[model samples]
Target chain A: MDVFEAVAEPTRRHLISLLAERERTAGELVDSLPALTQPAVSRHLRILRETGLVEVRPDGQRRIYALKPDGLQRIDDWITPYRRFWRDHLAALEQHLENQ
Target chain B: MDVFEAVAEPTRRHLISLLAERERTAGELVDSLPALTQPAVSRHLRILRETGLVEVRPDGQRRIYALKPDGLQRIDDWITPYRRFWRDHLAALEQHLENQ
Candidate 1:
């Protein structure tokens, strides 16, 4: 799955956001999200790993997950053109707000 | 559907990128994507419209579709924290390259 598809799910998006803050083990992620079962979180993590959004390293018996940081560049690159479009509109909005 | 879900499909992403360039009528979009049937293109456009990614308006007998720049802000906002993480890593990489 691509980053877009990986992040389409709310739970996976939350997982990415959480990993962005800091590295966490599966247990910690599970603890953080009480609504989801451990299996569900694991499944999400696997998808993230496969998509290269999150990299996992084995630390003794526990596996630690960290955001790849550069892994999202594909998505960032895809949106770069739209960013200009947004920036132009945003500048217009800012000017209007200033005029107000 | 959320922007991520709306954009998860490659064809939809292509449609969005195409629209970002300029507003296009349904016929124009259909012509651009010759691989897809007209009905398939119409369905994709409808999905984009429903997701707020693309706004549609009637022009004569054609429907003009334009990218709704702000509609992608949610995905942008969600990636903001990761942007910081990415920036930090990019800075480190830049410094490393300079040292080489």
Candidate 2:
């Protein structure tokens, strides 16, 4: 599955958000999502891993997972053209921030 | 549906890509996707409209569709943190351009 669909689920998006902060172990990711069963969360992680949006490595008995932001380039590229729609506003905001 | 899922469909994403260039008539959008039936195209447009990612207005006998980029902020905000993962590389490229 493409990264777009992989991150479509709310659970997966939540996982991406978590990994963005820092790398986490399999247990940590599962524990962070209280509403889901470990299996469900594991499935989401697997999809994320398969899509290359995430990378995992064995850390002794634990598996560490982190965001592999390269997969996100597809989304970034898609959004680039649309950014011009609001570029002037964003530029103005940047100007305001520089003056402050 | 949230904008994420709304744009998740490849067809819908294509439509957004087209609209990003400029507002397009309903016929123009439908014509752009040759593989999809007119009804299928209209359905995608309706979902985009209902999700607020796209807005449609009637122009005489035709309907016009345009991207309401504000709806895209959700995707942009979600992507903000992840951009940091590749920011340094992009910044380096920007610096190279500035130097030239």
Candidate 3:
């Protein structure tokens, strides 16, 4: 799956948000989401890694995961052009709000 | 599917890029993509509509499609936090370029 599809799920998005703060071991990541089974978290991490949104490295017996900022460039590039539309609308809204 | 999944396909992304410029009828969209069968294009359009990335309205005997800027807010919001990481990196790269 592409990065877009990888991030479509809320669980994966949450994992990304967590990794944004700092790198974490697979165990630490699983622990962070106590509600999910260890396997479930691992599955999400695998998808993220496969999509290049997250990078995994060996840390002795454990695997470390961190957000790969480069992987997100595709998404950022895709959204860049469309930003003008929203930014203009948002700017107008802000102006209207200030007047009110 | 969510907006991310909806836009994962390249064809869907193309349709979005097209609609970003102007509203088009379904037929016009299909005409723009001569390589795809009419049914295939329709399928993509349906997915876009279902995901709320594109909105359709009755235009005489045809339906008009346009990019729904509000629908993209979820994606924009998701990327907002990550922008700092990329922005910082990009700014540093720009400074380095100027120095060189």
The digit string of per-residue lDDT tens for model 3 on A1-100 reads: 8888888788888899999999999999999999999999999999999999988999899999989877787888888899888788789999999999
lDDT, residue B63, candidate 2: 96
| lDDT (CA) per prediction | 0.88, 0.87, 0.89
For A25-84, candidate 1 gives per-residue lDDT tens digits of: 999999999999999999999999999899999999999999997878778777877887
Checking candidate 2 for backbone clashes, the offending pairs are none
Off by over 4 Å in 3: A91-100, B90-100
Candidates, DockQ = 0.68, 0.44, 0.54
Mind giving the per-residue lDDT tens digits that candidate 1 earns over B1-100? 7778899999999988898879999999999999999999999998998888989899999899999978777777767667877788899999999999
Of all true interface contacts, what fraction is found in model 2?
0.42
Worst 10 contiguous positions by lDDT, candidate 1 chain B: B77-86
lDDT of 2 by residue, B1-100 (tens): 8788888899998988899888999999988999989999999999999988889899999999998857787788888878978776578778999999
Instruction: For model 3, state the Cα shift of residue B95 in Å.
Output: 7.8
lDDT of 2 by residue, A14-97 (tens): 998899889999899999999999999999999999999989999899999998857788798878878877776578778999
Residue B66 of candidate 2: its Cα lDDT?
Answer: 90
Give candidate 1's whole-model lDDT: 0.88
Best-to-worst ranking by lDDT: 3, 1, 2
